[model samples]
Target: MRAAGIPQGTLAAGQERSAGIEAPRGMEEDSGRVKISDIRVKHIDRELDPPFDAAWDPVPRTSFEATLVFVETDTGLTGVGSGDTMAGFAAHAHHFIGEDPLRMVRHVETIESINFHAGRFWPLEVALWDIVGQACGQSVATLFGGTAERLPVYASCGDLKSPDARAESAIALRAEGFRAMKIRIDPRRADEGVAAVRAVRDAVGSDLDIMVDLNQAWRPAGDITRSIDVPAARLIAERLLELDVLWLEEPLKGDDRQGLVDLRRSTGMRVAGGEMAQTFADSLALLQADAYDVYQSDVVLAAGMHRSRQLAELARMRNRSFTPHTWSNGIGLLANLHVAAGVGAGPYLEYPYDPPGWTPERRDFMLAEPLRIDGDGCLPVPQAPGLGIVLDPELR
Candidate 1:
């Protein structure tokens, strides 16, 4: 379960693995004084051979794209983050070029401001935290409070499949050490989706915790099609209720506060969503309205690590689960992972995996090698300085 920066020795549960690891060699004694020297962006694309047919997306995804953000310090320390495209960021890159890399609060605020006028470049904040962890000689998880060193992860399957196929996959994932798995259900194919869940339930019974994703939270770019209406979602949800699913994700629109409440109450299930809320206020509105039992806001996509910690804590205060949606690349997963482990985010984190089309190899194409889940189906937080992102040297 160890990644690049994990120590060689065995670590007791919840122990901080980066306790004594120093900053990289040649780094200054006073790494705290390091200033941001440069911020470089790298675009890497891996053409998918089989083409991923995710249930949420109509078109078969033929390739995977990763946008890598590197934050270099004057002290020769370079922390990396990968997530959304840094479009229009270069025009405003100078805002952070010469500033202190450890000024995480300031950088997060700046990125949010730029997000209003440019893009949601929260990965920059992730890069900054990576630098801050390195400067202080600690992993980001330790800096985020080190509540726990590991968190249970669920296999997040993307593609839509037949009942038998999905059931077979579920059994295999359970055998491979995954304690839970999330199955995506297309809004258009509601009946078949419920059938898939039933099949999985019949196959694994209580051996696996099942989660269902309706993917009605928000539509992707250029997707004009409206999501399923409330009645339709409720209909499908009623069917899934029989299978004893752990949680039902994105069963309604992000802004449909009343509808979400109705669904949760009517179905008597743990409703989850808020991953792609248009803004922070939107998530607050949903939370304030008591729309969800579980908050799946992604650290990278929804908000940077700092703000996401706020959301997770707030959700915890309300007795709501805070396992986030980590559909982005491996770095994005790590960013979310640190915060989840740091805050003791419950029950299960998302680990995207669907063989032949989507796998760890494609999700973590930026890393030198893919990160492996532990034997117990838990994802151990990286113990390395910074995010511990070791990019492939050949990726120019």
Candidate 2:
């Protein structure tokens, strides 16, 4: 079915790029007339040097895996995306075999349905955006209605470091031009988490804004779970507030809507979460419950740019802060960056930077060039067409 409001010929048919390139299986001479000819998924695994400590995970993470997706049009203009493994999309590929890439309204409906029966099809939606941008000859950020080419950034760390070590890291992050940094809280030991935040505050000396993440989103399988009761979360928030943490993230279970709201109200601290929410409807529920002061939803994991844009607007309408949680990988980060830039009014963006394990070099291994922050501690939204990422064959 066609998406309503996208008039025929709106995506005019013709060559989007330099002419004379050989077309693939399903091409028409009109560039706007494109079809999904093929789709492929790849898996990349890399071993960490010192086994990173995933704060929320039950076990130490010694390695990391990336799931890359490629969606090709009949004209041979391909778009790339990365996110959670598309476990069973191969079997359901028939649903989008010859579909229009720009009909995002229809595509979003298709994705929501596909996710219910088989795999999480959100990443495919990202690929669709990539294709649409290329076809329209504009950057994804521009497509999302953003004018700024750069967005403010904050360093985000995943490993659990000792107080002294974290202090050193915070100092270094400041030197790297970051105005802010986020500390991962050890779910197993709340005291250690509190101490780590205190150390960073002492080291930074009130120069850097610190956000603490409790990572109460998801846990690994077979791990003994620690329930963070309302009182427990309250006590921790009190301690972090004393240390002057700017925000507390995911202190309680993500679905505990009332509890999250209560934590924000009682502590008077900015509470952030919603990166794990599955749909815009789910986010609406969180908003209706006043669950957080800040809403962070990843486009790749949540519903894709179309839904994320709506969420961004909703957050603005509610007078709450909105930023994307971008820890997945470089591609995932780029997707959110465009959305955040498109939404505008964002004060900062998450820049995953846990050295020796989750560095930008490792996170962006597949990209032709790794994304880096400028002297102003901001990443310029890529101006290139599509997702603006070129795949590195060596890394693949």
Candidate 3:
């Protein structure tokens, strides 16, 4: 069976490219199409000089790891993407070998089934979309629908700092062109987190829109700890409301749809979650229940580009927001960007950054140039063909 939102036909036909731009030479056969020749995965590891104290992690991240996927066509054109470990995918590689890369709808169906029985291989979908964009001589965002040229960015800080330190950091971000910032609230240290939010609000006043993340959806590996009860979460929501928070993200578990709805209704604050819902079906449930004011799902992690486009549109039709959670490497983030920008979803998109720990340079070490917000604090959607990815030449 086919998943919802994916169109019925294939991208192999009725294709169009940007004006004046041309697809690579000799990329088509008698069929006027190219077949997937190979799918390769590379594991990249980079060590952090000063370990990163990620709010969600039980311990500091000493090194950064990325799984880069390369999908090559018979025409010698290759598309790249990065995300999950792609473990157990080697056994499933035969699924896409020697098939038309343009049969994206079919490929998306196959991958969705594999995801239920095997592991997540959506990055391959990202790579295939990358190939389709290059074949069309347009950016994937354009292929997805070219809705907006750029989107505003929010500094998604991952580390926890003292109230004073965090307030100082907020000031720095405001000075450096950040119009908004997200502070991760530790469930265990709810009071401390509230204090930090209060401090930042006092420091920045109304210049920057502040978002708070509860990080309660999924726990770190080996974390058997229980999530905060609804009563506790509700109390925290009340506290954050006074601080003028833009949104309270993941204040409850991903499955707590009713709790999320109730919290949003009671507290009157925008609730955002579902970043890792694992499927379009799961997210649809949340959207249907009116559980959140803003829906966030990483395209690479949960909904592939096709499904994400549909999800974003559905959210808009429902008068809800669709800003995705983009905390992965640059490629993964770009995947989210193309889909989000293509569908015009958001008042702000997540841009992971926290100085001296997680920076654009470290998050995008695989790219030739790290993506940064411009002087106006907008993340420009790459107009170049494909996802506009440029791998670092020195990165072997």
Best by TM-score: 3
- Write the residue-wise lDDT of candidate 2 on 202-311 in tens digits: 88888999999988755555765755878888999999889888898888888999888778888898899898787788888988898988889888887677888888
Backbone N/Cα/C clashes per model: 0, 6, 0
lDDT of 3 by residue, 1-396 (tens): 333544556234556334453434443344666989899999998999889989888889899999999998999889998887788899999989988898887789999989999877889999999999999899998887788888899999999999999999999999999999999989789999999999999999999999999988777669977778678888998899999999999988888888888888888988899898888899899999998888898888887778888888899999999989998899999999998888888889999999978999999999999998999988998888899899998753
Cα-based lDDT at residue 389, candidate 3: 90
Query: Could you estimate the TM-score for every candidate?
Result: 0.90, 0.89, 0.91
How close to the true structure is residue 126 of candidate 3, measured as C-alpha lDDT?
92
lDDT of 3: 0.88
State the lDDT of candidate 1 residue by residue for 1-396, as single tens digits: 554666566567766656566434433345557788999998889998888888777688899888888889899888888777888789989999878887677778788888888888988888888888888889999988898888889999998889999999999899889999999888788888889999999999999999999888778778877777778988887788788888999987778899999888887888998887646777788789999999877878887788878888889899998888899999999999998888888799899987856888898887888977999999888898877777777873
Report the C-alpha displacement of residue 101, candidate 3, in angstroms: 0.9
Instruction: Give the candidates in order of TM-score, highest first.
Output: 3, 1, 2
Provide the lDDT at 83 for model 3: 81
Which ranges of candidate 2 are over 4 A from the true structure? 1-32
Give the candidate order by descending lDDT. Answer: 3, 1, 2
